[model samples]
Target: MSSRFLILFCGALVAFGISGCGAPHSPMTLALVTQPTRKNSLVKATSAKVSAAHQRIVRVEEVPNRVVTQSGLSVPRGFGVQLLAENLFVPRRMTFAPGATASQYDVFLSESKADRVSVLRVRKGRVVSKATFTREVSQPYGLAFWNNWLYVGNTDSVVRFPYRRGTVKAAGGAQRIAGLTKGGYNQHWTRNLLFDRSGKKLFVTVGSSCNSCEESSPQRAAISEMNPDGSARRVFASGFRNPVGLAWQPNTNNLWTVVNERDKLGDNVPPDYLTVVRQGAFYGWPYAYTDIERRIHADPNFGARRPDKVSETRVATVPVQAHSAALGVAFYPVQGGNFPKDYWGNAFLSFHGSWNRSEKTGYKVVRVHFQNGQPTRITDFVQGFLRRGRSWGRPVDVQIAPDGSMLFSDDSGGKIWRVFYIGK
Candidate 1:
């Protein structure tokens, strides 16, 4: 055959092989037979890209001359602390809504005492406008946004309202989605809410009714989960005296929280902790406490009702200082912003500040270092919320801004403080 004809014949054979049109015995058929292997490898490569897209790699940068708040506090040398907004009515938890630009985001603050969700228009790291987003929220503590709906955790129930991007007010009235164990004068009343990455499951943390007592309600002292519309409510985990802060670790997708252990156990008996919360796992509240070594320490309240030794309880991942009242937990973004390179994958915790201990502890934010999705060390990131044997600000919740600044709410001082690294 002529050279041109041979070239066309070879091209036809290659196309037939790719399309699986060649005979089984033909040499060109081998390429078709192996196509599935190559296709599967391509699928795996695509999956790896998807996973990497979800994984964040945070690198530190620098910005200067932001509004510096006069709050007496100390952050790292290369960082600056400023009050983003002040005079918030007992703000507890914060959530952000989509904005027009990268620098413009609407921050929704749950005013626990004001019975409303307040909206703050943040433009380039400054509060431009503030207004009441919604009212009559019934002691809203936790705020989360999903699927154009804003979920608010009230003292007695979980409610949701319709929301739109860049809109200041909720579109409609609040709808009760789930009922929580509430009534009477309870010691721990705050119900913090968090949604899974898929937004399929909603997790709510209910504190114990009393200190170290057998809770009459099963949901008390436990983390509960349910559908987005409040169906199939079940206890995810139990035995925590007060699991206040809830966060999901990046990359691992593991649910982690910080718990406030029973008080009056002496100054340093049972330290507060940050731990990976497993499904249906108990952490030993009225019966016992899992120490740093994963050893079970029986609670004095249970006496013989609690065996001195028990199994099946998971220990804390990292034990914090006693009576620190660790209340809010937020993981640093995988794509680090202005913070240090070492801060990537670390968890920032807000210790609301202890009131029961002889000496004050935890009036600050702490950085829990993580290696391969597991905590390795805990370090103080923000301090000086307490000064001169008195505290003027008590941080209640923490959040990471879209621009990569660390923002925390201080209810005691009615202020929200932003901490960002000022690159050297």
Candidate 2:
């Protein structure tokens, strides 16, 4: 650890009134501390006096008599997993066809490799039909439906096609809504589209161009907000390395995102996290990151450039396994859905797995439980992607079906899996 990081860690121990402020401790030592939600938690990513010590992962039940379980994969007790669709070419985010009810719905997904939108007709947990909704486009990654328009967020632009619930493919060309900065450091290339709760504005997440460097443009490393028709574009927040999944907390209306943090920090330096993405918040990309002790530390490499920026960097809320590559997030709706009542208002994340660790971690989905509009615990919902230290699939994003089941995409294996409750 750098001297500055150590000093910041020690200072937190003293500030929190914990005993043994001077004694040596394992870097991974964990102690739970209360994190009170702010009065207006939705307005900003509130600072946690302390951050990640250890992630709270509960018991993960192994399901029975399932194909995925053959490879040692598992889901929670009373829940069962079934294959929804197969043979997709690198599917990413998903959206249910509008005007559908119950388990009878068509899901639209983006095939990044195919560069087209495909719609799958699902009936009672199985995909009965698949067809190309639109084929002519760039690297399409995000899909959304609003006001009879199927909005597509390609790698380089936002476009829309005339869409109807039962129509598998559109009739004409797309209308370009917005053009985006094409590539970045790792060539992030994936552009995610999200509509705010009010349904009047749209938010687009654009990642920084490099691993950890000063960005050359404002649009890089920031989330852009604009009118739904692609007008009035402006930076909503900056300093995000790669914020992938965006969702809204129901009770508090707080915007949440799962960020894929920088790599090469050795095994577990700063854990990847899900936090409220407040407007104008600087999330310490090249300058700092909140550590296990809940204190934000300046990056030893770049903190010297802007000491003031490092000091004011907003603290992260819920911290997960470092390098877990948290990508897509979706919270169960509080009003309606097929999930059990206990699951309502909880958020689910797709951990796309990790490559920078000695022993690999995070190759499944997790349930992030919330209390008083704040995340409190994380528990595995699905697993076994990494068996014997080798992975077969990488979960990219998660979504809740209108009928109450959960759907997630695995790009590596080109498959979609659905989980549902089988018992009380």
Candidate 3:
């Protein structure tokens, strides 16, 4: 469709101000006019063909010019995915209940639970689609498209769903890509997946099982890469207690991550950071933190004489304020279009926010500056999630839409916000 036609189509689909494409949102004005359904129907199991296929590396054409910008947008700032519009996806946290308003944005609380992932189509804040994650894939989290296959990372393992450009409901017999360390209170168990440029290497992040436990394999708190079929696994880097967000520099092929560090050292002792992941390099997790020398004067929680622990001795790339809880990272590539070249290789980080510190920190998105393939600036790009040290949204993962606009998720706020330039 022409650009003019596409804009009109979007506006028509969202005649009303709010629509739910699986993502959650505030109740609409119509909610007051109509009564909500008492109970929602359960999402039936998908066909065996969709759920049982064991295919790998399916071919997908280049992403559409305006690939769907939003999916499974949530509601209420921080609850569950909205069912309005053509809500194709659902939040891992919500389940519909009886008496749920049909106004698209009004979801009754009685049936709500955390969901894994939701699928939907969104653009310019409008939503389109009714197919949602409500029926397929178990607890989907990380969403990535490689060669037309949709790979979602969950708590325990990663699964693949076959999809085509402009296609919604995926062919669903999701294959288990890899198994992770089992349950633990401190285990940063959410597996977020990313693929390299050639689509050959798959990267999965497994956070530390605990705050600072002496893990036999430092990989416990690190990022790892392997084949999409779960073969030839190797630990990409170690030392991150919980490196939730992972992305590669668009041109250079260098990897980056945003780590949520351990807490309780002090109000502003150790800093949560975004840094370059070096292979076979340690990041000073339970033993050390953002600052190597300061660990000596910092909190003595684990004790002073654990002589075996390695010292940070050197500085790792550091970002914004301490305990800001930097989460997901995404690099906006330099496309051949009119978009500025300066933005081509910049990285955006979502600060999931922090609770352990007395003074509020994080809760916003920041951009990391790169020059000659090294981090030079970590500037704030989006803010206002935290108000007076309390958070309204917890920014998580960030992804670049097909149009080159940036999309990031806020689990705490239950919303996904998009960023783009309006000026020519």
Give the winner by TM-score.
2
The models' CA-based lDDT, in order, is 0.73, 0.76, 0.52
**Rank by lDDT (best first):** 2, 1, 3
For residues 95-132, write the lDDT of model 1, one tens digit per residue: 78855454888889998899989998999999999988
Q: Judged by lDDT against the true structure, how good is candidate 3?
A: 0.52
Alpha-carbon runs more than 4 Å astray in model 1: 1-70, 99-101, 183-186, 292-294
Backbone clashes, each candidate: 7, 6, 42
Better structure of 1 and 3 per TM-score: 1
TM-score for each model: 0.81, 0.85, 0.68
Cα deviation in Å at residue 105, candidate 3?
A: 22
Q: Against the correct fold, how does model 1 do in TM-score?
A: 0.81
Which of the predicted structures, 1 or 3, would earn the higher lDDT when compared with the native? 1
Q: If both were scored by lDDT, which would come out higher, candidate 2 or candidate 3?
A: 2
Clashing pairs in 1: 56-334, 57-334, 57-335, 58-334, 58-335, 58-336, 62-423
